[model samples]
Target: MSAAAGAEAWGLAGLASNDPGDIHFDIVLRGYDREQVDERLRFLGDELATAEQALAAARERTAGLEEELASARGELERRVPDPDVGFGNRVEKILRLAEEEAAEIRQRAGTRPRRSSSRPGPRPSSSTPCAMMSSSGCVAPRTCSTSTSTRPGSPTDSRGGSPERRVAWSPRTGED
Candidate 1:
């Protein structure tokens, strides 16, 4: 029944009827423990009320945590890049660029004059030797021994100062 209907039907009369002393019992050879039964009922009612309060508090906490979780998910969605749109577009653009570069390289190779021998040329005296990875073709090392810095982008002189000349080289394939 609705709260309004129940309130109209039953007032505070039920509260007065729960008196332990007024409870009726049939007389038998052995009588029931009325006092213990009354005490247990009171204890159980108190425990049920406490449990109901605890349930309400727990429900409120769960609602707050759920709201927090939703907001966190929203923030994460805003910050992180969409893999379908951004990543795929970037990959497609990179592939297109790489294809165009390959086409240009092939065109240049077709027009360029071929060398008679596949053997490596004589190494220059002033240049130092540096090894490349085994999977790729050999590279002619054009590093300067007098230079203080061997690292790329930063050219240095013998005294560990900035150098005027920059050493540069291209890798030649071992194949004909």
Candidate 2:
């Protein structure tokens, strides 16, 4: 007998014992194939295994990238100069010069001749200029000055107060 006929015969035999409803037997026999179901289940299991392997490979790749990034950062830390020693020195000298000039200005404020202006009230020329010089005798156009009178608390703090003071001794490839 054909597969469908065999299933129908089995269903009819079962119904004889239990007196199950005809609709129930029909529903049970329809669209039921044990072998085909088993094959589909195996296919799904194989797909799950493949997906797990891919997930594992992706995790490994992510870990490798993290390690590489850590190594690169370490290398960068080693190569970069300490800003506290290099740029910090230049900034400190500029600040000292500014303070001295401000003090001199305050002292001479009483006696020195002032520029006469037609505009009413004290029209203060707010432009303050400071010069910065490098070790190689190159003078920077702009200078650094702090309005506060207090000196830097620490050598590290002198360099913008950053804990990681990575200053390049010489200009980098792309930097001006």
TM-score of every model versus the real structure: 0.35, 0.36
Off by over 4 Å in 2: 1-31, 88-176
For candidate 2, write residues 88-151 as lDDT tens digits. Answer: 8878887876677568756866687644333232232232444343455535443322121212
Off by over 4 Å in 1: 1-31, 88-176
TM-score leader: 2
Residue 58's C-alpha lDDT in candidate 2?
A: 100
In candidate 2 the C-alpha lDDT for residue 86 amounts to: 83
Candidate 2, run of 10 with poorest lDDT = 162-171
TM-score of 1: 0.35
Please report how far candidate 2 places residue 36 from its true position, in Å: 1.7
Which candidate achieves the best lDDT against the true structure?
A: 1
Per-residue alpha-carbon lDDT of candidate 1 for residues 59-95, written as tens digits (9 for 90 to 100)? 9999999999999999999999888899899677666
